[model samples]
Target: MATFNLKTVAALLFLILSGCATYQTKVNDARNAIASENPEQAVALLKPLAEEESRDQLVYLLDYATALQQARKFKESAQAYQKAAQIAEVQDYYSVSKITASLVLTEEMAQYKGDDYEKVLINAMNAVNYLEMGNLDEALVEVKQLNLKLYKYRTEAKKNYEQNPYAYYLGAMIWEAQRSFDDAYIAYKNVYDIDPNYGPIKADLLRSARLAQRPDELSKWQKQFGESAPSVDLKNSGEVVLIFEQGWGPRKESRPENRRFPQLKPVYARTQRAKLEVANQSATTNEIFSVERVAIKTLNDDYARLVGSRVAGIGAKAVLADQVRQKNELLGAVAWIALNATDRADVRQWSTLPESFQIARMTLKPGKYKVKAIGLDAYGSESGEQMPEREIEVRAGKKVFVSWRSVR
Candidate 1:
């Protein structure tokens, strides 16, 4: 039998445990900054790790890109998002070595590849970044990539994968901006199919149909909606879309009873919804996607796999400890304690993700108008929190985009 060095094993375990904690600590600090509505501070905290390439670079990139976007560093944010898309992708088949490490130590022992829904969100958010940069080609490319991945997911990951309404809705907006009314209509149909009850879906469908010259679809919607397709004077009225984020995503907390699996808990939020006001008219935002629900559901969906892995890891470690104990009881006991100490769950996530995503749209006459994002409570009352007034020049026959975030 090979001789085992108790001191060496203990030292190594200490390093791994402390290293994971340190990295998570940095991410938590950044998350706190974001929650405080100080995105610049959050970016400063994560900028070092996010700018570098590392094993945990995916986490750094996701949070960093979000922070940069909130800080209005769109170009730099786009670069981080681009890097994450290219390099941090997790493949279907992981390396044996990675699996071995995870089994021997912790799931976090392997690389921190993002979750399934997160991967799709990356493409959608990247498309937004490209749109903000005025690069229509790249924006469209990102949307196309998002749909392709969604299709693969339907056949590969889940046989009956439910469509993400937000992704398709975003694609519709982009297509409309590019004046591809036909394509926009198709994407809007996907969104409508996924969420027939969404407040703005009907209006968007009617508008796209009229613009695309689909008389039959327009008449069909007109009858079903019990309203006529509102006239869209393409040469006189411009479209304005406000994509806003509310609150912050939940935080992961390790339980004392089961450190091997972390529990997700909601983070506090002072703002729930927002209203976009321009000139004299305003539109109330509606929820499109919810990160809180999605995050909980994602973890719950993985519970079975996590349980299996945890049981196998503990069993293997217990057998090894018993083998060593047969030779030397004290060393065997030490081994058991040390091995169990590293059984921590990987609690890392995209810390800067919002609790939910919302949108508001308006058709305005051509003018340079001041736009305001006024935060509101569940009852539609002002919440005393607001975004700085920004100006938007609505050009005739064109669409424009604006985004805001509220977290306190």
Candidate 2:
């Protein structure tokens, strides 16, 4: 039984490690295409791997869905996200204690249950897609799902983890659009409660109070903000809410655990903030909103716990492999090699995601205007030679939405 178990473990480890290498090679081309603003190319590259939902490649599905959305294929994007969510649902069976096999092998070997943030964001992105297509009812449904997921995660999160304020903020925006001022007020208030320092929520709370005709709430917010009710100036013009998704989000990399055997463990490399400039082409008026670095996903915490377990498992296996080697040199050699090979990091992630989300709003007379998001690097220098600019038509009494993704 001992010999059989060791051999089985060795074989499983070898397969898991080899799988990561194969997957990276397969996706490298697709990743580059996305960076070049050619999501169509990425979709073509990733579609074949994503066709089989039973394979449970959530990462592949996520990339495919993002590319489809970027290419303006909203319906197809939503469908792909739905399939990815289904695969992630299977992760519920793998309780923390049940992850022993994963620790002994590789995190990639475990079912790809999305992190809490990723789960909520799946709904959030779908909501954006639905809204962009002018499907208000469908967008509302997605926002409601996002809130419910956040509530559940909040209840289950460890003490160190906090609920996402952006999720609540987005829900509030949806309610505001629906003219459900009461619901919007409540959602905005929730955002305030989670992150009082978030500047945008302060303005939103005040606006919701005024719209809801809650005098007491209005007074409370005014005192909190140390100012009067900031006017929206929507009487003559419609509002354009410009959301800029700046740069490529963090990606997973493997690092050696120890100096000797050097068991590889996964870590995340977060992208730096891009200095963005928002401008209107007609008047060339611009409003600069600084991007806040929100911890949308707690990768550090997740990696710490995972790496700790992996280290213990690797150490135990190393001892056993040494014992087996003394008894039979060939078997021990094979076992040792397999153990090292399987010490691969879990590199799967939603790479197209932005490092941080930024928002800017402008009140413009319902007319056509060209809006531009000029990307700048850390040194306040132009990052993209050809800036990303889009033409938008703003209408009176309605909010126009524009989004730009600058994944440099």
Report the C-alpha lDDT of model 1 over 1-408, residue by residue, as the tens digit: 333565656675774567466456878777778767788998998889987866678889998999998888888888888888876565754668877767867877677788777777777777767766668788778878887887988887663456788888888888887789999999999999988999888988898999999999999999999877777787898878888888887777676788898777898876888999998889989999888888888888788888899898898888878887888787788778877877788787876788898999989999898999999987789988888998888988777788888886
Best by lDDT: 1
Q: Which residue runs does candidate 1 get wrong by more than 4 Å?
A: 1-6, 12-23, 90-97, 255-257
What does candidate 2's lDDT look like per residue over 100-165, in tens digits?
A: 555655666566666666776788778768767767678778878877776666675434445666
Worst 10 residues of 2 by lDDT: 282-291
> What would you estimate as the lDDT of candidate 2?
0.66
- Backbone clashes counted, model 1: 0
Steric collisions counted per model: 0, 0
Span of ten consecutive residues with least summed lDDT in model 1: 1-10
Q: After superposition, how far is residue 147 of candidate 1 from its true place, in Å?
A: 1.4
Task: Evaluate residue 392 in candidate 2 and report its C-alpha lDDT on the 0 to 100 scale.
Answer: 73
Clashing pairs in 2: none
